[model samples]
Target chain A: MSGAGVRFDGEAPAAGEEPQSTATLAAVAEAAGVSASTVSKVLNGRSDVSPATRARVQDLLREHGYRRRGGGARQSPLLDLVFHELGSAWAMEVIRGVENVAREERLGVVLSESAGRLTPGQTWVEDVLARRPAGVILVLSDLSADQRAQFTGRGIPFVVLDPAGDLAEDVPSIGATNWQGGLAATRHLVGLGHRRIAVVGGPPTMMCSRARIDGYRAALGVAGLPVDPGLIREGDFHHEAGYAAGRELLALSDRPTAVFTGNDLQALGLYEAARELGLRIPEDLSVVGFDDLPVARWIGPPLTTVRQPLTEMAEAAARLVLDLGRGNAPVTRRVELATSLVTRSSTAPPPGS
Target chain B: MSGAGVRFDGEAPAAGEEPQSTATLAAVAEAAGVSASTVSKVLNGRSDVSPATRARVQDLLREHGYRRRGGGARQSPLLDLVFHELGSAWAMEVIRGVENVAREERLGVVLSESAGRLTPGQTWVEDVLARRPAGVILVLSDLSADQRAQFTGRGIPFVVLDPAGDLAEDVPSIGATNWQGGLAATRHLVGLGHRRIAVVGGPPTMMCSRARIDGYRAALGVAGLPVDPGLIREGDFHHEAGYAAGRELLALSDRPTAVFTGNDLQALGLYEAARELGLRIPEDLSVVGFDDLPVARWIGPPLTTVRQPLTEMAEAAARLVLDLGRGNAPVTRRVELATSLVTRSSTAPPPGS
Candidate 1:
């Protein structure tokens, strides 16, 4: 408690400037009133340190911008790929992408799930520090500022894949052009004379989903069609959510002729809803989906979707983290890969056109 | 080559007996004409050793049945889960299963794909050796006898999940009752008054497919129906294969009224083929699938299939391997979980009945 506000010998760099005076381990230890070995143990993620002491030391380390130099040779030949949750073919594609890079680099991939949380647990960060992987790639997951400082202090680089929420501008992230994909999907349906098109957006909390809905609204505006609030449904990105939302929308007196489910899994749910309502695809109801997961092509009538290139995005994230680990700064910290419209049998002209 | 057949100072254990008098590392090194440090390097998967020397040293270690004692402290907190090919909802189920066990045990999961190969590559084995995971869980994949010997020499334990091919009797494995599942599937179709039933089995090389087909045959035999050779289609367990087989089977002059697709993906393919032919599910034709993947419930008509309990099976495999690593020999090295029939809207009485 006495060391809480003590000024350290090190200073943090100015915004947008490279760190010029990273304090050594001994300086941080002296300022925190601990032995250098204690600071070393904390950096190594040893569990022997008490939570109170660990937090105090971590705060001092961050305040001093203390980064260990030349720890690359000591790093384990591994990369951590953390996910918010592990379900669906979407994850499988991402896993394959990371596996590709891991194989090429001869590094083992450590797979962990945050168990549906937006960020990994404290224990996960501890385990990661102990193993000391070359880098980390997070999919739809973020870290608390303290957790971020912990990794930064250890010289461990991380890249976010498809960030679920707003991130600091300094954090490197890879994403698809979700807004553009949404616009293209809506424009395609509009071109097919579907004036009353419905949009089933994923969880509004997710930035990707929000961007997509914004694009949907933009497309309608560009096409000179008034955006109908009644036709927009907010649903979680899952099959059940899509099913419930679909059932409600289809049961309306004036239902839309086409529906744009935010993702492919939700689109499948919508498919079931349409099936139960005796609606034949493209005949009575047209549908579009995003992600273009492999199942998108296998389902009956095949889904018309925006190809998000999930695997490529994952590969890019893996590469970026590795590059950062090797001290190779990227030209840009934020990147959005191209998303293309894939036309299939699920979309058609409005009935009796 | 002079070290090829030279007998070392170690005696292999008798069949069905525990190993006795395990040779020392120094003895193996001397027998292989290498220094003890070189032999230790080989054990640690260090790449400095020449390939020839590495193979020679490994052979000597296996001949001696050498086991490193008290290396648990040095082992990384990891469990390796290798897949023959990372695809589909099937792999996802298995990954989730292993993750559950790993999370509880406070172990990190290292995932690898063999890229469609029945066995993982040599490089993968070397990396696994270097990482020294607590245990290994292999999915639909096998290892060469030499590879197995190497792991055994290092006191590493592994378990197979859903064995794709024949395995040695002593090899521990976890699987579902594929034969019984097939029998139940066919019996359900028969009970629905489908006398002319077609069977679309997975690859003949996979023991699961063979067992399932055999069960189908047994069910038909018990029902006093002759096994129609022309109605059995040998296809791989994939959507495209199902589509091709479905096209062929449906094109028969006297097409079968119902089909038992070996897996869910193939069933989806069959659905596409049926839709193309203007046949409605459960009315014009009946369908059955296996594995009971999440998509099975989401697809149109909600596929009637066999629930293989893949996640449970994977959990069992992971637990078994961990138990083995702790020298807790299981009562049996082979375990098969039960598979049950999940009846849905995909089956019905004959249209003319």
Candidate 2:
């Protein structure tokens, strides 16, 4: 009972209780008078299974206590994708990626938002368990220790996307090369001969934001330039924060020639701030952003920024979770896709260059 | 046998066959060995019910043929919100509204995309029925007669938001006042002394678009201005269409001083077209858009447009459907919220005036 492939009577054993007999797939199929593949299909909630046949197979499985290796019921034909917030183009990009894969796998995707919190409340876990989705993908969020254990105990696979905090090595996660993205953005500005550069970053607590700021500093260090403490500002990753940060940076006695933002929304706000002060982009103040969202190109003086492959990252997370759900272990627990710089009209040689 | 609240034994009666006895709430509670409130909560999939207790109550309900007044099984405490596409800020606004109400009600939301089709495919209904959500809200889409009947037969209430076509009086719907919105936009331009106003509207087949175009014509008639056939263009409601139409209109020898677009995305494209042709906003060409989205203010020279209360409309739709799920019929089958003009930097007196 302590080993894999355990079985029991009609009633599921109580938590912490071990059963005696172990039921094999072949044994269960033989007892149910069905092929092993048919049993598997029923367990996977495939649509091809006839209602009566599925009911019969489910009853037989329950009676034999045929647990699928680990502890949990059959996987429902749905996947849950939770986001920190669902009100941005960035979220839409990730959703489209997940939907592409989910559609191909004939799985429905459920979208949830944590309502601007770091993670969903305790009831979110209960809801996920009740639905029994095939897997869960949480973007910019993490599960608590207890929640993680519950999912592990139930053999529910979950993958984190762009985790907001330090992720344990054992946890499966997908993210972009934030450090390299930051380095690349700063290097591009350096190449344009702008030594006086300012940084407008996201929450000081977020891991990704810290990584990006570190990259910016690393670039400066490599260039043998001094890091100006007054030039760095940290705030939430939103437009209003960007506007405020930009105003402060622009009002400096010796203002920086270029500004780098944590994300594109902030870059837009910076544009507003500059406009209010009667400054022209590229000519008066060069600006760079990250996350190269769709609107990055649509905005006036198409933004030059770091391109994070949001869609690809989401797709990878979806694929990894689905593979795990299919009883296949991941080759690696952590996957980080590359990021690059997208040069547009927003950046040019600094004033008086 | 055919009366309301009828129940049967373990076997569900064949379609068209009616049962003789109706299992009362007391009988279901007694058989399941739970209080009436507990049974009711279990039937509604309330989070308060323990898993074991819920399973027991569900089994008993099936054995006793106990169901709500309508034909379907108990609600799943989940609501499905299907969108034509989830790749826009507009969708996000609606989702936020629905989530606000759903959070308060302690109901989970399931978001789905119809993938740009007019309606979800045939299998969508089956998949939805399998989940057994309390109700469904469709944005800019409609169900066929057969699909509507299927939901009706299953006791699942559905409401349409911003319906793309003519909805039957019996179908509940939520929409903005498109005619009034269009009227206000055109009147703003007319009041600015722009007699040669050009209209870039959406597809002729969409009812809302038609209403908007009609409103434009009505405004011109009220001002004793002749409708300029040459200035009217109709296409899909998107950026590319607006850009193409703007180019065509601007290419004309007798170009209008101002242009009014069906939506904000199209308005943005018009801005690009005007910029590429060396025209300045308000100074050279006044532009008025509809659906004052978030970007309307963010764009250079904030767009003067019609305010379509999308979030409020979505909230209203969600509230209506939840009421229907709770056995309350809507006070009105169709609800149209008000739309108003938002004057910003985009519109001004025609250049010469």
Candidate 3:
């Protein structure tokens, strides 16, 4: 007898015989006396399936061995959330956002850190595919062509959160308006009567970082000010990079009166740099930061910053991935939440202006 | 023919028939020409199983339908990590520590925030059980007796991180030496000649918070000073509570020369209170905080605080749970890592000393 049809009859199977292939969806549908589309809907966890119909389809699917291709036997109820690292309050905000949605849906979340690496290793994909989660949400990371194909082949759905690089046209992604955040931060400084403003931003090649810098340039252009390459410093969106860049700008003979950083960590570093030189905030230098992390409000002089809705973006990504997992297409391929300027105590008219 | 013994023969099955219970481990082992213990070891993912034997056993187990009890069909490779909240840098530190260990073990982590609630809802347990994670790690939270019994019944392991309440004698947990941290913080202020010291601590019902307050009282007793009831206040270990408590202590007829807070967020809040009252740190009022989170170093004048190794605690909890999940009993029911005093810019002798 072929091994595929062997059932549990309280009798032992022959030694060394293995099931060759899983049964087809069509066969499972026929056995359940339901249309193939209904079976497909049930498999995708669509809400339209009645409870009785869903139960029947599930039992038939189990009996006929209709598992996802290469995904062992059953799909896990958890969703995989992958991050490049988990060291900052920024990550905590994103995590909270995802947890909010996950709680509502009663789905568990699996978190993976890529160990400060931009891209997840090949083994990461292999492990995820093996777990066969209901969906995936990747933050500031991307998948290789091969990895994408593997997930697609297995019918797994994934959504990107603030992707660090360009994504395919069809890939659903959630992010904030980095360009608007940068523009607002720069404009706030410029509005404070600062003529010589400097910008310290993240890695030059990172999409979000580039967009912020572009926005800074656009703001300066709109104000009829010439863009000075000397005032634009590239940082790694970290405190050390911000400190080093701040020190460089401060040491210059013609230092700018105002500075805008790509993120809050860098802005704090700039504050240290300014402190070391006995420069008073607002009186000596006006500073603006992005991300508006919690510490921004608690600093000596609260930081004026552009608030990126990281939590909301994370929630959107989670919701979108869940929708896609349930066989529903996204309403839009790319979602950009709004960014707003929070005026705290860090910014003022330039010194002696 | 009996439905259980039907052969594949590329034919559809008759309707309305269901498969029986999955094959037992004994049957799987017999088919694979191995001992039952060998198959059990493979199922538990123990390191003792040889690759060749494991592969053969896995194939046989698949053929016989040997799935984990109540785990649908497969056990997910993820570990559930639940927290009280994810709004603070402290939480981030813990997450980083867990990620470090999880990465080394080649396991995925699932994060959940209980939204500042002490206990997870009923659905939380149901969802976790449904996912069938290898293990679970809960931070500053506890499971109900029923929840614990459910996990135990399903053969899933769980470890508590910095549990707020007393645990069962046999439950595994990881925490810091809160009493020592408190003593060190209080002793530092005492050594600086601050006799009139005040304490702002977390909820009295929390074990760690109570330990810290006791340590504070211990340090005062060691110095032959009376523990003034007026100088001790209960807080929620949050910024707002600190600010309010600081204002109360500062407004006292006989104000304290120094104040020690339960956590860094409260310390920052005290800083604001001091600022509003035109008090200069160290010069006018000395402050000490606990849990030297990253913000403690970046804040103005930095903060003198007790350093609780949250990351290490999380790592230990991860390791302990992984061991438990593999059927290994913990070497100890409770693990307490060391805490140390990190002196920075925020503490000094009383102004008149």
Residue B312 lDDT in candidate 3: 89
lDDT of 3 by residue, A1-353 (tens): 12121111221112221344223677877887889778665654445677688777777766765546433223456678898877889998888898888777665778888877877886687677656666889999888754565566456889999989888887889988999988998988878788899999898767999999989999999999989999999979788898899999999999999999999999999999998899999799999999988889888789999999999999999888877766666678689999999999999998887
- Which stretches of model 2 miss by more than 4 angstroms? A1-73, B1-73
Which pairs clash in model 1?
none
> Candidate 2's C-alpha lDDT?
0.80
What tens digits encode model 3's per-residue C-alpha lDDT throughout B1-353? 01121111121112221234224666777888998778655554444677688778777766765445533123456678898777788988988888888777666788887777777765676667655666899999888765675566456789999989988887789999999989999999999999999999999878999999999999999999999999999989889999999999999989998999999999999998998888999888999999999889888878999999998899999888877766566679699999999999889889977
TM-score of chain B of each: 0.90, 0.81, 0.80
Q: Name every residue pair that clashes in candidate 3.
A: A110-B110, A111-B109
Candidate with top DockQ is: 1
Order by DockQ, highest first: 1, 3, 2
Tens digit of per-residue lDDT, candidate 2, span A255-315: 9999999999999899999988888998999999999987787778789999999999999
Which of the numbered candidates is closest to the native, going by highest TM-score? 1
Over 4 Å off, model 3 = A1-74, B1-74
Calculate the i-RMS of every candidate, to one decimal place. Answer: 13.2, 14.2, 12.8
Which of 1 and 2 is ahead in TM-score?
1
Off by over 4 Å in 1: A1-23, A34-38, A45-56, A62-65, B1-23, B34-38, B41-65
Superposition TM-score, candidate 2 onto the true structure: 0.82
